[model samples]
Target: MKPLALPSGSRWSAAHLCGLSVVLVPTCFLAVLFIWPVLRLLALGFGDEAGPFHSYLRVFTVPAYREAILTTFEIAIAVTVLSVMLAYPVAYLMATVSPRMARLIGIGVLLPFWTSALVRTTAWIMLLERYGILNSVLMRAHLIRHPVAFVYNMSGVLIGMSHVLMPFVVFPLYTAFRGLDRNLVQAAMLLGAGPLTLCRKIFIPLTAPGALAGANIVFMSALGYYITPALMGGPAQTMVSQLISFNVSEQLDWGMAGALSGVMLVLTLAAFFLCRGVLEKRLKRRVVTAARPYGEGLSGRSGAGWGMVIAGCAVMVFLLAPIVIVFPMSVSASPILMFPPHGLSFRWYHELLSRPQWAGAFFNSLKVALIAVPVATVLGTLAAIGLARMKGTFAQILEGLFILPMVVPAIILAVGLYYQLTPLGLTRGYWGLGLGQAVIAMPFVFLTVQATLRGFSRDLELAAMSLGAGWFSVMGRIVLPALMPAIVSGAIFAFITSFDDVILALFLTDVRARTLSRLIYENVLQDVSPTITAVAVLVIVLTLGLLLSSLLFQREKS
Candidate 1:
């Protein structure tokens, strides 16, 4: 049955009177900033800019364009499969291990998750280069005489995509595994079910939520991947996103760009529906009662258990190695970038300040992030409060609309924002790009605040109302202070999300406002600068500090 539209309270009571104003303000903001721009882009594509079918027709007719679409599908699917295989065992280990051990291992898993995806991709680029670390090691071992062509090829694209998307796979599976009942397994074992049968019938069904949801997240996210493939993939490996960007910026072919984006959007929606259906059928809530001994639990130290532990450690190493490689590369004394450095020097770090372009990009990212973060934090916090207090389809629909920006490939938002901003001369500087990023950052902010609200006590709200405090007074004196940790975490996340962006920067910024990620992106393509590694290291440090602060705050709140 559909949920009723309002909560079980007086529509105008003090407790609920802050009410829809909270929803309306953010809803209106998203409407202007996100929905309108996307709808505009779609209209322009199918509109009379030449003809409705002009661009759509080209995607179908052109051989290279057709291949780009097919290759994108292949890469996304491969990334989905590889990430799950690598992440599942680690997630299981975390569920079964001691609390302290799980915490230690979780930090290893999350460092890469919280750090910039583009930074990680850049590190992989350096590692896989002709004179890069992997080749240097392989040659020293007499494995091969010449460096393999890893970058500007399909192999490089796959590795980058897998590294960046692995965390999405790990986090959801960890959640589901932690929530599973060990007692059920003991009950099944007592009923004469063997290990294989227990896994096939009980465990797999229980974990369906994480496996299916995480794969859908990875595959959909990969579908619009641009920077990794643009840098790592060869000319023959052009993707739908690259195709859209090229047509819009280079060819002035709006129709074709729109058609390609429309198709990608459709593909994203289709995959989500198909995955959701499977998850629902397999993961329906069920009652299973059982008792268990402490020593003999969900995962025993049988041969199979030992095998999984070994595999989980290996997966953790694979996930962490690429991110860890960049720090050593940054301080190398070689004029050219090198790993296993001949000598360590801070020259590249100093050079960042001396170079005008690098300084400009760094400051530009800061400016954009500063302007965007507070706005996203307020709007997201308010939306979370509103949705938590309300009920039914209207609230659900509004929440879904806010999250729409996250579900669509970022390339779609880039195209739409560029089109909407250009006509008003808003594309040249920080305001346009800042608004674009606020849209991008909204979901992170909303989700963080929403998670905190789920566990909040309604009794405090009721007490304040009984004492005759107004909604605004209750919010100012009670709720805001209570939610300080989550609010701050959400703001920090919004800041990094804007700062680390490159897709919108590629489309929206001119020479005056190119962001840090854009500069790294442009430099990696033209030349492998030592400064690129230095900048990545600096970003890694800043992001880690921010992440650690958020974690500490959450711990204190708990």
Candidate 2:
């Protein structure tokens, strides 16, 4: 669609006023609920009368806080490196195989991506438990005489985080490979290069930019991890985010929390720009120049071709293991959350069905998503329309303002909203949590709608307007129908993003406003029961259905 035409002349004129009207709801929504709240939290860091930097000194000097800072970066680096390693071959296979095979393995890779990180973390705990399937297999085969301790440790944290983050790495690499030229591999082979030699000297170097980009994504995302570490890790594994939460909720130290949050925000912003800066632009151009159709030059040798495919399959299985393992575990007759059930049955699932708390969580999640998604979709669509027609610094600034929720970590938002909302008596109810979720979910809708609108035309709208159709009629009859698919896509994603959230809910949810993720977190920490397995299975299946629906929608669009 063509960009919407900007109103001309004075800012107070009717046309300009109308355009500004489109910006009011979202801008004010983000301002009062999102931006002002964050600004308030940042200001609170200096509430200490000792000095402006007093809270900073405390965070840096305190051993507990110091350790969280160090642990955050350490885990982020490890997660990024491993994600790159595991994801590369699968991405390569996706780019090289037939479309059907690509789609099959791609779903395997995406199963964990679409599922909640909370669910995946829960699944990992079960998978690595002493009586879990992994240990049972090893024990029966004599690989080990006893089950190993895997849950509640750094090992479990890594496994859970890696499963969650691998998809972030895969997507950029897959996009990069889709644009890669195959002739480089063929040329290298024709020049008498062996498989390893060609891979190292030609393919690896060409895709190095993609790897770097993917690593940046993994690192930044992992830096803000809360649920995985909280559930799967020990005391020593606490990250900077958990430290912030602890300072606020347990210790009642908002100043220190704000200071620590400030440090994180600065670092996150710096890294965001660094990752998206000039180097990324150059890399994008290279990827595009390198782009070619799949399967042209992927098969150079019997050993190398089959070996890479096998590696990819293994990696894909690793990605899907946590999601797939939960199904049978859910039905296991053992009420103690063990594997190799005393017998096969649906005992846990039946128990889950019997719980009112579980039902409340389910309803609460739907309630939040239902309230948030539509508001986000409409305002985001309006923002997209306004942003489409604006120009220069004004447009860039507005666009970035809307995207701040996505760029800043959820921990910061949680802290900000708590400090700001509590003062106004807005923190205790569903409205508070719903508004926060809508702000976070808003950017998702805006970006997706904008993406589709980039290729869309408003010529039909112009034609209808000229033919004397009113604004509503044009919107109702022509423009909305054209953009409805994009709206639906964005709303679905926004709903999932809101529904799968744990960090924001942790800070904002009250007794009556509890969500599914909160319930899962509570169960993991206190109950350690088999009902979590049933919950995980249900969540995984719902996510799978969403993924398939998205795929079918895309297929239809294409």
Root-mean-square deviation of every model? 3.7, 3.4
At residue 125, candidate 2 shows an lDDT of 77
What is the number of backbone collisions in each predicted candidate, taken in the order shown?
0, 7
CA lDDT for candidate 2: 0.81
Scored by TM-score, the top model is 1
Model 1 lDDT per residue over 215-334, tens place: 999999999999889888898778999988998989897777888888898999888778978877666664433234222245457676678789999988878887788888888899
TM-score of each: 0.93, 0.92
What CA RMSD would candidate 2 show?
3.4
Q: Given candidate 1, what's the lDDT at residue 269?
A: 82
